[model samples]
Target: MAPKVLFVLTSHNKLGNLDKPTGWYLPELAHPYHVLHGKTDITVASPKGGEAPLDPASVDAAKDAVSVAFLANHEAVWKTTRKLADFKGKAADFDALFYVGGHGPMFDLVDSATSQQLIREFWEAGKVVSAVCHAPAVFYDARLSDGSLLVEGKEVTAFTNAEEEQAGLTDVVPFLPEDALNKASGGKFVKGEELWAEKVVVSGRLITGQNPASATAVGEAIAKALGV
Candidate 1:
């Protein structure tokens, strides 16, 4: 049987206290969905369920073919996402858990007890746990069976401080993803040559991608880890 993958998205839609709209990054979800949908059973979920918000600026279908296709089919998937709090499936039922990111995750997933528990359960069960860009914020409080931080001593990468600066939201976001990951993991963070460069790190079954550019590679890494 093919591995089942759960795609967790953020329900938070505001950009900090600015009231600017923001949600999951389109390419971050689109690229990975395109790559893994066929190889694995992909299920979408969010903390609040229903229609997870999309970052307005990141919704350009003209940017890539994957984005175009995803938008065309958005209604079917977006309208039916399951709520993470109400998901009936167990961690063992899925082979992997993927967190899609935008500025939103930094607010909700970072402190979500449900998300933290799920990540811990998935990791402890020997299932793959992966995230991209701001999605890594989910690891902020996740712990292992031994109670050690999940990303502790693990090679990981996410949206960097420089990249946040480039996006000009360094101060707008609650906290910098790279900084949070480094502090939470005792400095096991890594990055690429420049801002937005594609960087995917696979530390055992824990996979991470640096930015939108790294989304597809992150999916490929997850597929490779599952031997699919």
Candidate 2:
């Protein structure tokens, strides 16, 4: 049987307190989804059971070919996701847990008790736990069975502060992913020399991607970890 991966998307739609909208970033989800599309079985899920919002900016016409293809082929999955709360105590059913990022996860998943619980369960089961871009925000407060931060002392990478600044959302988002990850990892979080460069960090069963540019690589790493 193909390895089953649970892809977690953000249900939060509003960006900060602004009138603008945001949710899971398309490239972060699309790139990774495309990478594992035929190689594994994937389940789309979110904090809410129904539709999860998509970051409008990521849907621009200038998006890469893979992103376009993903929307055309797999957007239905994105439109309807399983409620994350239902997956509690079900870690063994999955080979990995992946968090897809946008500004949304910084708000919802970061504070979600259910999300934290799932992460701990997956880690304790020795299954792959991964995220890309701002999705790493979920790890900001995630602790393992021993009561230690999941990212603590683990080499990890996520959307950088510099990249957040570059995107002009430095102060808009609730918290910066880089800073949160740095604190969670005890300064073990690393990034590329330059912003937006593809970087995927794998430490044991934990894998993280620096930004949307590294999303596909994160998925590839998960596949390798699953021996698929």
- Report the alpha-carbon TM-score of model 1 versus the true structure: 0.96
How does residue 9 of candidate 1 score in lDDT? 88
In model 1, the clashing pairs are none
Model 1 ranges with Cα > 4 A deviation: none
* Alpha-carbon local distance difference test for all models: 0.88, 0.90
The whole-model C-alpha lDDT of candidate 1 against the native structure comes to: 0.88
Candidate 1 residue-wise lDDT, 10-122, digit = tens: 98888997969988889998899888988999999999888999888898532888987888886666657899976433898899999998898998889888888899888
Lowest summed lDDT over 10 consecutive residues: which window, candidate 2? 54-63
Q: TM-score: which candidate is best?
A: 2
Query: Which lDDT tens digits does candidate 2 get at residues 1-228?
Result: 999999999999998988999988998998888888789999989998789999888898327999988888886888889999999999999999999988888888898999999999999998999999998888888998888989888898889989999899998988888888898889998999988989999999999999988988998999899998
**Per-prediction TM-score:** 0.96, 0.97
Q: How many Å off is the CA of 70 in candidate 1?
A: 1.0
